[model samples]
Target: MDALYVPQGRSRRFVEQATNLHHFRLGIFLEVIDLHLQELDNRFNERNMELLTFMACLSPKGNFSSFDKENILKLASFYPEEFSSVDVMTLELQLDVFMDNMLSDERFCGLQDLNSLSMMLVKTKRHENFPLVYFLIKLMLILLVATTSVERVFSAMTCVKIKLRNSMGDQFMNDCLVTFIEKEVFLQVPDEKIIDHFQNMKTHRMNL
Candidate 1:
């Protein structure tokens, strides 16, 4: 335990001298934690963290233990197009009724998540009764799915546009990206149809 810690692939003179415990605590562990914190900060900035907190209020886990009437109302305010000033006023009342109904309802006792809560509400025909709340839930779910889809597109772009293809034009890159990202849909398109469509675009020396 008293032995000095030597980092691999480097000279001891160029590196800081320290014991294994000190090196692991101050160097490796702290550096890894800082990197993780930086990544989290980048991914969840102020706006995103606010949205996440609001969305968590809508979760039905633990019998809606996380539900917050005020936060949900604030979440509705974020989508002014969906909830007008008048609608927000109505939503406040609706939230109260919705909470009461959900608490008293036996069917809503064990909902695991927002998705299950949404499904249960629709299945039990309670969505009609709590339309505003349901709308908020749907909006949260859509935002979650949209964020994932956008990340997927960015990830696909890295794969589709490699170092060799970096010079591709924006329009061509977008077309290729769309095809690559939605390969399942593109795969359903027959090759003959694609060839005929290209052939009909202009006169060709040979029939493609």
Candidate 2:
């Protein structure tokens, strides 16, 4: 279809006039797909996706079907503070034993996820026996949960520091943010206790 593409609610002078196929292929389809790709790139960039893939290798679902010894070892390398060179070398052997222990043990069979696996290891005291594997599982769980929490804090910051409060000092803003984000804990405290605490900070002639 070579007919001139005139978009609705727009004048030809304001919009570029092109063939129908060319306009749809380049302007509409390509632009929409490019935007979606950009959004995906922003959300799950190369590093994040790679880390997620490594994390998935530790999943216990389907009886630890996703487990990969090499990838798990690579994942350990990411946390050198926790896994030293010696620990990493020993972890390879531990992973094999851990896999055998998990596969042979009926208790570990049919486990749902990393959380359940961690709980089961703690409950059965196997975490002590397989400390390295247990540590990796905990790290994976923490990584996932901490990412969500950090994002949530950023979201909360936007709510706490809106345009009207943009000029708030950093220390005051931080205090306000802590109270706002942890409102549940703050709500439990009595107003009188808060007032008394502030009043007692320094000697005062009068108490309100």
Candidate 3:
């Protein structure tokens, strides 16, 4: 709290708010990673089914009934208690109903297809020996997205708290910060010309 560059009262409040936001974001990130792991496992476990189904789906003359049957059997084996004959019928019916609803609703029609999603999930699995490669690529993507977001927020904050306009009310400051963070963007530019270019661009675009 003392190191946050705020008064004691504000520091306490800011720290609490920051902690809650941190926890919320952390929870989301953890859940995403966990889901990724589950997807990788599913990909590895169902590689055969995935390959077969994908090939069938892509072929003009190929039939998917056999692949579908095999997938059901595999699922039943993996979750015997949850997926029996009755459960399979129920699942298929539910899937049909869901697809029907999606087709009828404009909001849902643009959503990703489940079959494509299933194929993608299966294709993302890597060998056990090359775990680092996949993780490194994922880490790089995450870092790129995160750094871009942070940079955008910092840029907006700088505009909000300019040298001559530093005397902001507390409520105004909070609102500005929130707006900056929520509407953050990532722009690519060389570091050497960044300062000059940013000022010129802002002036030209009237974004400042």
Give the best candidate by TM-score.
1
Candidate 1, overall lDDT? 0.91
Query: Arrange candidates by TM-score, highest first: which order?
Result: 1, 2, 3
Model 1: colliding residue pairs: none
Q: In angstroms, how far off is 89's CA in candidate 3?
A: 49
The top-ranked prediction according to lDDT is 1
Give the whole-model CA lDDT for all candidates, comma-separated. 0.91, 0.90, 0.47
Descending-lDDT candidate ranking:
1, 2, 3
For every candidate structure, what is the RMSD over all alpha carbons to the true structure, in angstroms? 2.5, 3.3, 19.6
For candidate 2, lDDT tens digit of each residue in 1-208? Answer: 6998878887789987789999999988999999999989997998889899988888878988999989989989989999999999999999889989899999988888889999999999999999999988888888888989888788899999999998999999889889988899999999999999999899988988
Cα-based RMSD of candidate 1: 2.5
Candidate 1 stretches with Cα past 4 Å from truth are: 185-208
Displacement of residue 109 (Cα, Å) in model 3 is: 30
lDDT by residue (tens digit), candidate 3, 1-208: 2232333455455454344445555656788998999877854566545533443422212222222433433343444564566755655454444334334544432324334323332354421323322232243345447757776777777788887768888789778777666653423435557667767764575533
Give the per-residue lDDT of model 1 (tens digit) for 1-208. 4689987999899988889999888887999999999989988899899999989998888988998988988889899989999999999999898989999999999888889999999999999998888988999889999999998889999998999998999999999989999999999999999999999999999996
RMSD to native, candidate 2: 3.3
Using TM-score as the yardstick, the better of models 2 and 3 is 2
TM-scores across all candidates? 0.84, 0.81, 0.26
